[model samples]
Target: MSLLLERHGQCLCGAVQLDCRLDNSDVSACHCQTCRRWGGGPLLAVECAQPPVIGGGDALGIHASSDWAERGFCIHCGTHLFYRLKAEPHYAIPVGLLEGEDWSLASEVFIEEKPAWYCFANQTRQLTGAELFAEHGQPDDA
Candidate 1:
């Protein structure tokens, strides 16, 4: 039998919830400064086919840390829920959102910007700024 696209997620308080179609398990750990400050670690996220049908979207607080990025979290419990790029318009749901499952599958991104104190060591791919920019355009290498 073909496997179904299973999905399940919850907020810090278990009050907010989500259910949706997950295209793939492949996840990304973002090491940008904004991510580090918001999540206290690399942000583990999975791109969803569509926005998860959230139960408490209203209760979620939005923090626009940068002109291009906005972060959403639970106001009551302060659980970081989503990281969204305004240009992309798609929500990068935190893998932690998946409450009780093996939510692992993220590759690393923006490792060059990561702090030295926290060592990735052997966790995920470490992408230099130049390398990441090359994947798209001529982003400033320096």
Candidate 2:
């Protein structure tokens, strides 16, 4: 499929809308408990260098999920919109948000913290939190 030049997404109640452009397809499935609790599964996300052009920005609620991460959602509908890196200025939008297409990006970043009851059958690279952080800089203590 064509790389997204512009993508459109909206919240559950349509109270928040976003338009964005992304170049990379490096998506990941985050299994951290925080992520699983927030989205009810591994969060499938893709990266965007620039913030999406948002409409009804007033309806969005942001929570600092960690020292460097924040979660954004619709206050009215409680739809998770995106997760952002507080220091990096980049964002990971839920793959479900891209209006009308099925796009498979890079699938990695699974935290071993995932419950044994669930297993990802996809042939994607699987890494625990420590592995992911080690690949970046230090090992994850979480």
Candidate 3:
């Protein structure tokens, strides 16, 4: 038997809404410098097979954060939306933006880059930046 979980949420100002079908109830954290700098801390997110159904497209703003990834946010309230891979149909949506109680920590990426000042007590699989890249293939140098 299997279970399916779906979550719905909106931006800070309620300018954009998201309907996401999660691959699992587990959430992952990214501790890479880029993620830290982007959100002022680790990004706790859930993977989605495709981009969420975004409401109010005009209020959404996208930034090319890296050669292979782009970050989306609400322009009106400066709310973080989702991080999408440019070369693939992959997306990681911030857990905070979604409404659900089924989520649990599953993994942490860029473990080597995680700062020592903060830590999570959850037992999760950890992967360093190199390992993550090796599995997903490094982003183009473009």
Candidate 4:
């Protein structure tokens, strides 16, 4: 199936909760410079089929990370929440924020920006930024 049934996750301080309809169980790693600067490393995130149902008081903070994408986080605890596309109904939530064991790193994007200091042993389908951006202006798959 293209979409997993449902998944639940929360911020580090439990100030924010999310009910997400995941597009798939597989996770993707973004090695782009923006991702690196945002998270200090590759962002291991899962794609959501639609906008997550977020429940939080005033602890949620959103930043326009780029012209086409935005990043959400917990203001109280500084937990990385989701990286979302502004032009589409797409959300990529950090795998660690969610509770699940079936998640696996399926692909890596912006391979050219990946640092040489670290590496993953798992064999994953990888694409450089140019290749990814050339795929109809988006990644071929989430």
Q: Clashes in model 2: which pairs?
A: none
Per-residue CA lDDT of candidate 1, range 1-142, in tens?
Answer: 4343668788879767878567777677788777887767878788777677778877878888766567878888988778766665477888777744655554677877877887644566667657755764444442
Query: In model 4, which runs have C-alpha deviations exceeding 4 angstroms?
Result: 1-3, 136-142
TM-score of 2: 0.84
C-alpha RMSD between model 4 and the true structure: 3.1
lDDT string, candidate 4, 1-142, tens digits: 3546598999988999998988678889999988999899999999888899999948999999877789999999999999998877878999998887888899999998899999999999999877866763665433
- Score residue 28 of candidate 3 by CA lDDT: 93
Whichever of 1 and 3 has more lDDT, that candidate is: 3
lDDT for position 69 in model 2:
79
Clashes of each: 2, 0, 0, 0
For model 3, state the Cα shift of residue 108 in Å.
0.3
lDDT of 3 by residue, 16-80 (tens): 99998876888999998999999999999998855788889999999999777899999999999
Best by lDDT: 3
| Ranking of all predicted structures according to TM-score, beginning with the best and ending with the worst | 3, 4, 2, 1
* Alpha-carbon lDDT of model 4: 0.87
Overlapping backbone residue pairs in candidate 2 total 0
Q: In candidate 2, what are the lDDT values of residues 85-125, reduced to their tens digit?
A: 77566788897887756466456675567788876666787
lDDT of 4 at 127: 90
TM-score of each: 0.77, 0.84, 0.93, 0.90
Error of 1 at 10 (Å): 1.4
